[model samples]
Target: MSDFIEQLSPLHTVEREEITKAFREVFALSAGKRVLFWMLEQAAIYQDAFAGEATNSTNYTLGRQSAGRRLIEMLDAVDPRFYPALLIAIADLKTIDLAAAESLAKQQEGEEYDVEA
Candidate 1:
């Protein structure tokens, strides 16, 4: 649990139910939707982390390359607890592709399974 999560406890009963509904809907989404959900969350997280940083053309390219590598590392890890990851995944009957009521599965090809400045 986090202080941030605890802060959400102030929500009214209806609000809490709505939040749970969000999870339920997300759980019902398909693979592509699940991918987009996590991707958008990552975009928001990165934007918050570096919204004011200065950068040059050369460094921007290098930074993009680094981000790609790290993204692959994360996807391969198959664990949301990895440092830079979606806080929770939407679960379905088969498996929770990305935090829902189902189990978390491995990569599509196999059951095989980080961050920096």
Candidate 2:
């Protein structure tokens, strides 16, 4: 047997330290629970695919869309504790602009001040 072939094993057991730190910084207890629950749910989908109980394409695609929607909904409200993780996840998300978000927040703050005047 080839050396490379012998190494066929389970997924890499890498510790998600950075991601965990990001999670701690971005979410409160309830939000963190939601994130972890979603993670486990998605992992189960992967497990099903690996076991041939689910299709590769359909389940993966649907799972990803579901996860993304849930994450977006969780992040839609401005919670400072969770904003950093959202920013990290959205770093490469071209559809959402951080600068625009900041500007809109500033505008809203200005409106609130004006209302009080």
lDDT per residue, candidate 1, 1-117, as tens digits? 356556665556467567456544543456544564566445443343343455564466556556655654544343444333332433342264233322333233244421233
Query: Across residues 7-99, which tens digit of lDDT does each residue of candidate 2 receive?
Result: 645342123334445655545454554465456456452343342555766577666757655655544433344545545544434345567
lDDT of 1 at 82: 32
Best by lDDT: 2
Candidate 1 global lDDT: 0.46
For all predictions, the C-alpha RMSD in Å is 16.0, 14.1
TM-scores of the candidates in the order shown: 0.27, 0.25
CA deviation > 4 Å runs, candidate 2: 1-26, 29-56, 78-83, 86-117
Q: Quantify all predictions' global Cα lDDT against the true fold.
A: 0.46, 0.54
Model 1 lDDT at residue 22? 59
Error of model 1, residue 27, in angstroms: 2.3
CA lDDT of 8 in candidate 2?
A: 47
The lowest-lDDT stretch of 10 consecutive residues in candidate 2 is 10-19
